[model samples]
Target chain A: MKVSFFPGCSLEGTAREYGESIEAVCKSLDIELQELSDWSCCGASSAHSTNEFLSVALPARNLSIAERKGQDLVTPCAACFSRFKAAEKALTCESKVDVGIPFQGKINILHMLEFLCREEFSEDIEKKIKRPLKNLKAVSYYGCLLVRPPRVTDTEHWEDPQALDILISRLGGESVFWPYKTECCGGSLVLTRVDIIHRLNGRLLDMAREAEADCIVTACPLCQANLDTRQEEIGDKEGVSYDIPIFYFTELMGLAFGNKGVRKWLGRHLVDPRPLLESKGLI
Target chain B: MELIGDKNFRDVVVDAVGEEIFTCYQCYKCSAGCPVSFAMDMLPHQVIRSVLFNQKERVLSSRTIWVCAACETCTTRCPNEIEIAKVMDVLRQIQQESGKQAKEPKVPIFHKAFLDSIKKTGRVHELTMIRNYTQKSGELREKLKTGEWKNDVRLGMKMFLRGKLKVMPPKCGGVKEVKKIFEQAKEHKKA
Candidate 1:
């Protein structure tokens, strides 16, 4: 399947492994990722927090670019997906805004997990799993964007999304049920309010342990950064050794696909997921 | 911003958002579902109530709107079908227009530095964005005062060692288009 890919800013910087792993897995599956040439930022939380018009217009610009491609647009970053959804809502709904761009909102936008979940890919996906992510108990965290605002995102099960869990099960891994699966991680507030991030992310880490999960898996770059990079600080502040690896869905897919670049991607993790994968004997 | 209505603050908000604000019957589901409500000075339900009562200044000055992560969990679970997150966004827009306040001051700085990075490079480079954020927020000095900057510096160095912090941004080909979008969107705000 060929699709327009928008590797938002995080993928190039902090989430480089996610970008690399997505490419590696897609190549193994014979799926072509035609990157949206010069796709700019989605305006994320910043634009909406300051200016609404700019927020919708920013993503509308990219949507316009992809609309011309006449292909379904896909982004791995949930933040970008949500931002594009916002633009789609504003440009196509009853309360449509004139974003000064020719955004028909005709292209169907999907997150990477959603793109992989298509029925046509499942048989091929099962055929591609060489490592069979056994002994990998994961909490498939959907975070905030992938499923929320039921009307805007049009997500059927917003409160209890099953997209990641479905993908994890198909990959030969066990997924744990947890209440904080869709909780907020104080995104972008990491630099502004570390205390808030500690409190919020600490709750998620503690809950993951309570659920007896091995690692927290997510598709959003901000959620992973907040959980992975800040795990140690939260552990120290709370006086407990909460050692957990936060994995991107793509990384685990690459691991299961037995793609060679999985290790290089895993090595970039702040929490270093190597020990977890090694302990599972899946590496 | 020249809201659609000028008679009352409630009308202004309803116009910016929708008529859903009137449908909110103080269910408190929004506040209950909010993950960060523990840190909010004004709860999500209370923010809506304040707006309904036309408490514009109080709603704008409170820390609840800024602390909100826009998770939309509240919006998803609202029994009244009110999109609370959109209301929060409108409140934030009005707050930005009314001039700066001291509640969660650093949050706006983060947004500014964030958008400025996108404006300059057509995408956000973490190192550059964070540098600009720290410079604007005086976060380093504040952390130095409390001796907590060590942790931040250590974390950044670790990210750098992992090669996650790139020294240069990618060559974005649509920077001019992005700038034009921003300019035209500003015009949209004006009209």
Candidate 2:
């Protein structure tokens, strides 16, 4: 199926691996991604805080563009998905009049996790896995926004959003339950303000480590950026120890596809997923 | 700088503030990062404590309630997962409805204006939001002096040309569900 795909800013920049992995996996799934023509920024964390209108309009413009094309907008970035969904929610709320913002047309925003969890795709995914991820213990981290406000994301469930865990389990990897799975990864504060990040990141890593998982899998780009890139720094300052690699859900799926050169996509990972992928006997 | 009541309203305060009040260890981490805390008569932690202490009048009327940007810094810091920002939202709703007088903070007004802009336009139209906010806040002259008009006009024109800013609002689906959510929020305030 072809749908308008929004890779978000991070996916274009630091998280290109995520984009590549998504493309790789989609191709394997026989799904076609039609890029939205001339899409703009999703207003991210900055726009939402600096100017509400800019935030909503930035994403709405992209959505409206996608809506005009008669396709749902699918995004890989959790923040992008959440922000886009938020704008759609704000526009749809009748109280937009009360707040002085009026209702606009809505766009269907889908996160990659939701897309991969489709029943039809599941059977194909189960059948296509050439290398089962047997004995690979993994932790699934949601890191907020994916299933939040429940209404916005429209995922399976709000409090217990486990599609990621379910997907990991389907790949023959055992998904471990960790407490900090849905907790905040400190969002944009990773740069501008970071006094709290060391603690937050440390705690999350500690939880996954405690769960004795081989690696942590996440769907959000920012979360991956923070967890993967900053793990060493957090380990340094907090005096904690962790060398576990962070895997994008797509990266894992790409591995399950068991195609050649798939390891290169995982190779681009900051945390060196080779050791973990090797443990699953894919390497 | 002021303690409004003598009684230890800790139970009432904790109940009102919810469970996250005592979770704070007074790290000042939230205040350090807060954008509007400089203008707050009470720090973010103190406001949480005031609510925890059942000092409703003082907590609701404090300048801190008005100054919060809803940045969620305190909530982010609280080791106990207390939603200090959400609590401030509840307090702001109370302050607005009680007709109690408190100094209006710039950030909250800006946020309201921002939300108002979205509410009206279905998406945010920057020029309209700033204009509406300036007029409502009576900051038009200062806004003009700050050269906000020139920059806004330039950017607004650019966005308009790009078709990012819609000239009209979009029709809403599930209007009743949205309304019900708002109605429940209102009832929450009344209760």
**Counting only residues 3 or more apart in sequence or on different chains, how many pairs clash (N, Cα, C under 3 Å) in candidate 2?**
16
lDDT, candidates in the order shown: 0.87, 0.66
Q: Model 1 reaches what TM-score against the true structure?
A: 0.97
Per-residue lDDT over A1-283 for candidate 1, one digit per residue giving the tens place of the 0 to 100 score? 7999999998888888989999998998899999998899999998998887889988988999999999999999989999999889889987688867888878999999888888999999999999888878899888898888767777888778898898899899998899987889988678887889999999999889999999999999999999999888888888997789999999999999899988888888889889888888998
Cα lDDT tens digits for candidate 1, B65-177: 89898899888888777889989888887777667674888898898899888889898888889989888898878888998889888999999888788889767999998
Q: Worst lDDT window (10 residues) for model 2 chain B?
A: B173-182
RMSD of 1: 1.9
lDDT of 2 by residue, B1-191 (tens): 22223334345334444666667777777677565565678988787766665677777768776545444445554557776765775666555555555565444455566555444433334456556666766566665888756744664464344333445433333233333333333433322
DockQ list for all candidates: 0.80, 0.04
lDDT of 2 by residue, A70-127 (tens): 8877898888788788778766766541233333554567998888898989888998
In angstroms, how far off is B87's CA in candidate 2?
A: 8.0
Shares of reference contacts reproduced by the candidates, in order, are 0.83, 0.00
Number of the predicted model whose lDDT against the real structure is largest? 1
Model 2, runs deviating above 4 Å: A97-107, B1-191
- Give the range of the ten consecutive residues with the poorest summed lDDT in model 1 chain B: B1-10
